[model samples]
Target chain A: MPISLPDLENAIRTAIPVAHLEIEDQSNGCGENYAIVVVSDAFEGKTTLARHRFINEVLKNEIAEMHAFSQKTFTPKQYEAHLQKST
Target chain B: MFRAAFRSSILSTRPSALLTSSPSSFSKSLLIARRNLTQEAKEKILDAVNATPVVLFMKGTPDQPQCGFSRAAIQILDMQGVPPEKLKTFNVLEDPELRSSIKEFSDWPTIPQLYVNGEFVGGCDILLGMHQSGELESLLEKNGVLPPIEGEATKSSS
Candidate 1:
């Protein structure tokens, strides 16, 4: 089943201490595809691969049901630096 | 589907006395057998990854990707100037065994996985992030998988 954006967002929030989260539904209205940016202190000491794996583990069930799931993760400090650079 | 059939065939072939004596041990042995099968698949995957400097296990060919993520990964590699000669792609959709085995082999849950010098690189999101940060270019160059710079040889000669 297609998971709603809010439901997915809530799931992530419940699983991790999220600093910032953005979930964009890329599958039009189907909810099968999502592009998410997650900022969490839980990812502080992890490599990119590790961080992605952590999130992947957390959303295992949801991801199994979805067709596509794209994620970008950052620690709070990295997210701040990224924001500064982007702006 | 096929896995279930295969499992049933294996179970059927086992002597009924053993199956009745210790069902738990029988299942444990079955698990070990399955693990050995995966080990064989892992070796084959290792060979494939080491076959080229840049190996991409994607859903389809670079020219015609079936998934958006796979297409994006191909584009990133192209943008990074990964030489076609140095890169080898395996379409996971073509091989059912490979489709499942690659995931277990990499401990990664997704497709369009890139391997440089037999090392696992992240999927599309990571590739895009690295591409934007200019890390992908340096990585390809460092691996010697990218084409030579246009004017470097002539510049040195001059």
Candidate 2:
């Protein structure tokens, strides 16, 4: 019953109905804990912390159950930068 | 004995007066002192987390919480059967640098952070949802922790 990586993903997916989303479990400290690169127009007007907060709000329950989530809530442009950096 | 006492007094007073006497040194030294405190706080948090099996970096202590989220987290733990002895919490509201640095350290930009077995766990809402679904019980079981109650766990903090 412990929160799993997929459960965290499902929470974010449900919280932000964005165009794209990727959840990574970065518990290993090798960028393997948990990273969610979310693409949402909802991030347009929000500051970095605000965007993070939005994700936090969405995953409030999951956060309490799971551990170590590093989120990059992004607009389309920011998501694009993220894609480029990863590639 | 008089000379020893005088030297000790001078040593303590000398450092205390520098900041009060000079405005520039005051600000600069204050900045340095703040930085040292920040470093020390981070170390303390890490050590505490590493030492304790279950730890929470929360907005207030378990007995008296300051924020709704923190209060909710404590409630969830109580409902989920997490005993008082197994839990250790740090009040983030008391330390600004710790509040900010914890975000950076965990890359988890919120309070009420939970750690199980020296690993980072998510914040409040996540904990509640897990509790509801019974996932919390299993996690505690895996860690050799016993759950508090089976039914009648329907109490909310606020």
Candidate 3:
């Protein structure tokens, strides 16, 4: 009756073909809380708030059953910059 | 005999009252405070923030902002003459605990927080407004560092 991390990851991947994605189960295995980082060109022209809205729209169904969701959405360019810096 | 009976009843009820509270419930506040942190983790985070004048808790670092807000935040600060080296950023993308703890620390639900003197100065919107009004310059002035604003070329465009 609860959504798993893989299920949440699938939902995000289905909605947006992101270059990179990380979903952390912050609910202490309670299946109610999640934190996600998604990188894609889909967010290129969007504002932060808009990107968040896009995710909310895509996950509207799962959200109803979820207790807390923390998200970080980035464009490909930004993700590339991040990747370069870390290395 | 009545006095002895009363003494026995009083002594018996005291142990039951104490037994009903578990060790956790007895130290509820301490437990709640410890729920999200190990003492060392909290100290490390606090130390990191305090050591850096401008701290950003974002999805990624300055060179790589993992979120639109994070990118915008870094860009805005850079545009204001606060270079990447002048800032200390934490990538919440890497650490889930730091991400949630930061939100709890600042009492602000948003990321890309700006801290000067280990105090929260607000997020992207506040930074943008301060940069435009030249208030950011004044704050930097008080800190004994003055740098020219970098967005002179795009000042009127926005």
Candidate 4:
């Protein structure tokens, strides 16, 4: 019942208009654990907790099956700032 | 071995103590036939959350965290200057009931869940985000859970 990377990406895209998305498989080859960064306009005006809750709701089934899941979410504006700050 | 000891400890405690701790409205829904998590377990978790001002339901003790995320959480709290006396950690791995019940209780799927003043804060990712943003410092300060700044008090007195 391990979720494929494309399937997870598609699930997020279909649910929300993703501006940017990065998913890293942290569980070696088992595909259970994931570290993801998601950027979307949908996250605007929402607290970090609320954004995570929204993503959790979208991937509820996938998350339940996976062993561990970690995510960082941001609005487009924040993502832009984050990118500039990193570089 | 350890499981048996944990089980015996639960059995030794008065059943009334288990029943008396109020279960929140959210936990009542978990009572329905969906999962194996029990009402007694939820009540225990509720009590654990309120046991201290800063409660961390993690995979292991703060001194020796088993998971990377749990360790990172402990580090963040330490970096925030949260007093050890004000913090309490529950190793969910030690208790099967708590391991499952806490997820249902907080509506969060991950471990290393944090509670400030009995409110569900978030998991490691959220905590790390807050830590980097400087919001966690203010939040801890506002809640009065963090230790007082060293020089500020002395400076004001002088």
Per DockQ, the best of the predicted structures is 1
For candidate 4, give the docking quality class from DockQ.
incorrect
lDDT of 1 by residue, B111-149 (tens): 989999999988888888888876777677677786456
The candidate with the higher TM-score, 2 or 3, is: 2
Candidate 3 lDDT over B1-158, as tens digits, reads 89755552453212221222233222221111233556677787789878877788888877778776678878877776765565788898799888777755654456767777676776665566567657766665455335644656223444
lDDT score at residue A57, model 1, on the 0-100 scale: 53
DockQ of candidate 1 against the true complex: 0.18
Strongest candidate by lDDT: 4
Per-residue lDDT for A42 in model 2?
Answer: 58
Q: TM-scores across all candidates?
A: 0.76, 0.47, 0.46, 0.80
Per-residue lDDT of candidate 4, residues B63-87 (tens digit): 9999999999999999888888899
**Candidate 1 segments whose C-alpha is farther than 4 A from its true place:** B1-37, B147-158
Per-residue alpha-carbon lDDT of candidate 2 for residues B1-158, written as tens digits (9 for 90 to 100):
89755552453312332212232322222222122336676687778888877888888788899876789888888877677788888888897877877765665656778888876666665576467657667777677667445554434334
Candidate 2 chain A weakest lDDT stretch, 10 residues = A26-35
TM-score of 3: 0.46
lDDT by residue for model 2 over A1-87, one digit each (tens)? 455667666665654457787777655633324657778765676555455555654565566555455566678987787679779
Candidate 3 clashing pairs, residues 3+ apart or interchain: A82-B64
Regions more than 4 Å wrong, model 3: A1-87, B1-38, B145-158
Superior candidate under lDDT, 2 versus 3: 3
lDDT of 3 at A11: 69
